[model samples]
Target: MTGKSLSERIGDLGRRLAVEAHTAWLAARDPRVAWFARLLAVAVAAYALSPIDLIPDFIPVLGWIDDLVILPLGLLAVRRLIAAPLWSELHALAETASERPSSRAGMILILLIWAALLAIVYWAVRTSPLH
Candidate 1:
């Protein structure tokens, strides 16, 4: 282990961590993985919003180590709770999101509806000074 190649090791770790987090997120988005995904999302949010850190942020080189290490570990742990069918559905959803839509009309309809809701919300908020 001469020279110790710190950069290479860190890069590899980063890649793995990203894949794990993404896989968990995708799995959670699927209806089959809904329950587990919601739970995982909650836990991740809690950890992110909590002021406390597993590894305190005072250390120089490893201040945010918990963010890197703990998140990936939690993602992997959530991944274990996912089922095969849900994973398959999630992969299908990913593929669908990448493909161009077949119906421009449908997309336009959805956009119009969203825009209308946004307009209504904007009007309501603007009229209400408390908001």
Candidate 2:
């Protein structure tokens, strides 16, 4: 077959992931995309970055399922919903960004958001109306 070799396919996957990541970042901001699409893009990016998984990797089979099955399916769903022209444009932009961007501020912001959520939950539990 004239298809790519195993090594080539592996390289292609690496490149494709970079492009998808770039597209997701772009989609999060582009007004041309629908709100739901934007949200999906953001969620995908967050899921990739998050250390905590839907199923933790320590578990035998089920843990890998989230990483192997769920994440890819979710990304595929997002890709199908995204406009082709926009995806292409974002992919081109992603290709140019060979060196990934840094965002300490973004990390801090995310941490703050989690902290705030925890605080609210804590307060609610401490003053439970049911109690």
Candidate 3:
């Protein structure tokens, strides 16, 4: 077993994931990256940075699995899809990037998505005979 405690290991993983996500964000915007890689990069970056998750965290086990498993897999896929040299350059830039980037557009999009889902739920509840 590694010397680090579980919490410490988890923290390190989180940091590494953040950096990888940032790299994907950078790759998505760069013309040097392949078109398919760029497409997946945009998705990975958006999902990683977004406050919402595909699986809500309140659920036991499965919720954390999505964060711990799916995200890392996505990051790994993006890394593999990118050429080695390009990945290394982006990773370096991501590590050195002092200010963590925020996206107003992403936030807005999430909000809009939530709003639409809420509306659908509300309509369903109102129209239901069991209500």
lDDT per model vs. reference: 0.67, 0.79, 0.93
- lDDT winner: 3
TM-score per model over all chains? 0.47, 0.59, 0.71
Inter-residue clash pairs, candidate 3: none
After superposition, the stretches of candidate 3 with alpha carbons farther than 4 Å from their true spots are 98-131
24-111 per-residue lDDT for model 3 (tens digits): 9999998999999999999999999998999998989988999998898998999999999999999999998835688999999999
Better of 1 and 3 by TM-score: 3
Give the per-residue lDDT digits (tens) of candidate 2, residues 1-131: 99999999978876676567666877778888899988998888677657999999899989877866666676776778788888788767867786578799999999999999999999999899886
Give the lDDT of residue 63 in candidate 2.
Answer: 89
Tens-digit lDDT track of model 1 for 1-131: 57648898888776555444445556655565558566885576466556788777898758787877788677667756777666556556545554545898998999999999999999999999897
Give the lDDT of residue 117 in candidate 2.
100
Candidate 1: which pairs clash?
Answer: none
Provide the clash count, candidate 3.
Answer: 0
Which of candidates 2 and 3 is the stronger one according to lDDT? 3
Give the range where candidate 2 is weakest over 10 consecutive residues by summed lDDT: 14-23
